[model samples]
Each structure stands twice: as structure tokens, then as C-alpha cells.
Target: MSNISIIGLGGVARAIGARAIEGGNAVEVIGRDAAKAKDLAAALGGGATAGTFGATPVGDLVVLAVPYAGAVPVIAQYGDALAGKVVIDVSNTSNADATGLVTPDGTSGAQEIAKAVPASAHVVKAFNTVFGHILAQGGPLDVLFAGDDARAKASVSAFIESLGLRPLDAGGLEVARWLEGTGLLMISLARHGVGNFNFSLGVDLPG
Candidate 1:
């Protein structure tokens, strides 16, 4: 099992921390509010612990569970602390109404975040397509991920599997834009086509 450090105190952070702990990975919860981070870590149990905000994470795999707007700022704050770490960007760069992406025309939120991190650090886009509650509920969910580094993707794939989920690589980091678009599509589906938020986007294979 991989040592995991999750940045955020939201539903997404809670879900990932819980699953990571359940998978026997060491979990460290980090947030701006130290008390809340401790509370969340305590709540998670299973040897979960709280980490100092803006500090070098104790885990090789760092999960950035913050919203898209906060992603870059948080990375900036962490600075060189994230060097050599496989950073997982789990944020969606969608507008408030979920009408479209907030990222620039060509680049994605993940790609933009990648630019902010250290040269040695790798950014892998993932978990943006899944709802926190559904993930918390636990099941064999398909997690689509994109990253430029093969080694980083492999590490993330193993981490996803540790959470009882399947990891599907959606090509290089350049593909993150499409993944973000897919995230927006999921929201639109929930509000219009699907009429609810309890469902997840997935694939069906011909067996």
C-alpha cells in the first residue's frame, strides 16, 4: 500500500482518505484548518493522521482534493515541498452553472496546475468524474486518469486499485481537457438527462 497525503477537508478528501485507509494505506489529511484536519483524520480512524499544511507531504503520492480555483494557489503555497511527488489533480475546472470549463481554450486545469508544480513533480488528472458520496459508498468504480509520465500514471493506477477502483488511462496530460469536458458533461447529465446525481459515468465491455 502507498503512503497517501490528501490536501483538502471537503467531501472528496473524506471519501479518498476513508478508502485509502480501508485499503491499508497510510493516510495523512492536510487542510488550511488544522483543527478540521485533525478532526477528519480522527474521524477516518484506521491509523489516519493529520499533516501540517504547506509542508512536504509524508507520502509519495499526494492527492490534491481542492476545487479547481484553489488548486494553483495551493500548489504555489506548497512550492518545492511537492518535488519528486506524484501529485493527483482531482479538480474539475467547470463554471458554477456547469455550463462549460473555466480553463483556457487549449489547456486544461490539470495542465495548468502541472505548470505550477516543480519540474521533478508529476501531475496526474483523476477522480474529477466521480461523485464524492458514491466513492465514499465504496464499489468497483472506473477512474479515468491522464498524465504525461508513465511512472506517475502507474503509481496512480496502483493507488486507485488500492481504493477498490479500476484505473483507466486516457492518454497523456494533453487529454486532460477532454476529461474535464467529460466532467462537465456528467454534471449536465445529472441536471438534465439523468435527472439526478446518484449515477456515475462508466464503460461497458463486450464479453
Candidate 2:
């Protein structure tokens, strides 16, 4: 079991923490609000703990479950503390209206986050495609991820499998831009065509 540190106490963070705990991984929750983090950890149970916001994470894998804007500051604040660790970027660069990516065409949220961290810190983009509600269900769903680090991707893939979810590698860290686009597309579909939030984007293989 892996020790996972989640850097938020919001819905996404809570969902990931709950699933990690269910998969028998040690969970440490950190957020700007210490009381909220402690409360979330208490609610999660399963021996989960609350961690300091700016401290080095106790887990081998640290998930940045906060919004895209929030993630950048967290990465900067953590700095060398995240060295030699797998930092999972679950943030998307979508605008508030879900119209387009907030980041420029050549860069992505994950790639930018990677640039802010130490060299030894492996940044992998995962879990940005799925919504919090779908993740909480702990179900058979596809999770697309991208990163330059193979080992980090493999570790994330293993963790996804442990949660009974399928992990699909979408090339290197540059592909994270596409993943964020997929997130925007999914949101647009949900708002217009799909007309509901009970669905997820997935790939279909030939029979």
C-alpha cells in the first residue's frame, strides 16, 4: 500500500483520499485550512491523518487535487520538499465558463507545474478527466494520464488499478494539454449534449 498525500480538502481531494483509504493506502490530507483538513481526515477515517500545508508530504505520492491556479502556488511552496516524489497533477486549465483552456497552446497546467518543482520531483498528469462524483463511486471507469516520467506513470497506473479503475497512458507530459482539453470537452458535453453529470469520457476498443 502506498502512502498518499492529498493537497486539498475539496471534493476531488476527499474522493481520492476515500478511495486511497479503501485501497488500503495511508492517507494524509493537507490544505490551507488546517481545521478543515483535520475534519476531512476524521471524516475519512480508516486511520487517515492531517498534514501541514507547507511541509514535506509523508507520502511517496503527492496528489495536487486543488484547482489549476491553486496548484501552481502549492508546487512553488513545496519546492525541494517534493524531490524524488511522484507528484500527480489533477488540475485542468479550463476557464470558468469551460469555453477554452486558460493556458496557452504550447503549455499545459501539468507542464507548468513540472517546471516549478525540483528536478527530482516527477510530475504526472492523472485524474483530471474524471469528475469527483464518478471517482467517489469507486467504479469501472477509464482514467487517462500523461507525463514524461515512466516510473511515475506506472506508479499512478498501479494505484488506479488498485482502486478498480483503468488507467490509460496518453503519451508524455505534453499530452496533458490534450487531457485538459478533454476535460473541457466533457464539461461542454455535460452542459449541452450530454445534459447530465452521470457520464464519463472513455475509449472503445475493437472487439
Candidate 3:
């Protein structure tokens, strides 16, 4: 990936942006609060930027790091500008489970993002479950990514690998629903004290 645009300057975006900068990619960070974006960009120190969501330049890949509800409106604002771009959905739907905790649902934030963006946009689901605290370590984790477009999926997989994270292709756009749900189900673990946000999904198939 040559350039990466991160939409949202939250903790998640910050972690991912820092990793992107470390990888030598020119990063543009867009957020509602200009001060926060500038602060983050300054910290990144590798051609990072602060701007409105619409001002984000066209890049090899774009990462949506905002809440679920925020994704649709941002897509609308971008319009045709997002055509042919690879979009990664790294947000959860904020739902919970049987115990008053975030429940993972069948339809996820990724699916919703695909619907919101133009058909020309290759939207991939990823980064939703990784916590900011763990992400900053620049270590690898079992990351599940879903997209209908093979080229786009491959591109995102490469970016994930750059962060030292393992990539798992979860089939197509629909698989995003399950991935989103998994993130929500994780919330229950934290609520019940069975696990904190540190809970992560790891797959170890019998070889």
C-alpha cells in the first residue's frame, strides 16, 4: 500500500495510523475534531495529516475506524470520490448478548458499510475486534477479513501482514455479519469478567 487514509481519529484509528506510518506509508487521518487529528498526525511523524473526512485524499486503501452509525453518512459525503478504492471496516455494531453485554449479531458493521458505499468501492471487513491497547504493540494476531472483491481482499491482507498480523479470509461480504457479531459477543466476556477487552479469537486447527 502506498498511501492510507484513516477515517476517524479514535484510539483504534490512532493505533492503526501509527502502524501505517511505521510501515513507511503516507497516512491521512480524517476526523470531526481537527485538533485531535493534527495532534495525532504530529505524533505519527511520517507525512501524516489532519483534515475533514471529505478532504481525505484518494489512497491505495481507506480504513473506516468510526462507530457503526457514522460509517453510512461518511460514505454519502464521499460519494463518487470513493470509487475503486479499497475500504476496510474496522468498527463494531455495539450490540450485546444475553447478559447485558455487547452481543455479536448476524449482520455486522462491515455489511452495513458495503451497503452504504458505492458499488465501485471494494469494502472489506477487518480490524473490528482488535483492541487499541494490543494493536499499538505492532504484534500479530489472527485477523479475519471479508470482501467480495479478490483484488481488494488481497490488498487488505497485505496491509494486515505489514502490521505483523495474520490474515484469515472469511469468504465474502456476508461473512462480515459474523465477524461483527463476534466482536459484540466479546463484549459479554468483558461484562461478565470472564475476559476483558483483551479477549481475542484465535484459530488453531488440528494439522
The whole-model lDDT of each prediction reads 0.95, 0.91, 0.79
Q: Which digits, one per residue and each the tens of the lDDT, describe model 3 over residues 36-130? A: 88998898888888767686355779998887767889888888778878999888776433332232355566766777777788899998767
Candidates in order: C-alpha RMSD to true structure: 0.6, 0.9, 2.6
Residue 32 Cα positional deviation in candidate 2, in Å, after optimal superposition? 1.3
Ranking by TM-score: 1, 2, 3
Off by over 4 Å in 1: none
TM-score versus the correct structure, for each prediction:
0.99, 0.97, 0.88
Worst 10-residue lDDT window, candidate 3: 95-104
In terms of TM-score, the best-performing candidate is 1
Task: Report lDDT (Cα) of residue 170, candidate 2.
Answer: 94
Best lDDT goes to which candidate?
Answer: 1
Question: Which 10 residues in a row give candidate 2 its minimum summed lDDT?
Answer: 157-166
Q: Candidate 1 has what TM-score?
A: 0.99
Candidates arranged by lDDT, highest first: 1, 2, 3
Q: Which candidate model has the greater lDDT, 2 or 3?
A: 2
Please provide, for model 2 over 1-207, each residue's C-alpha lDDT reduced to its tens digit, 9 standing for 90 to 100: 788999998899999999989989999999999999999999999999999988999999999998998888889988889989999999888998899999988999999999998999989999989999989987788999988988888999998887778899999999999999999998999999989988987889999
Stretches off by above 4 angstroms in model 2 are none
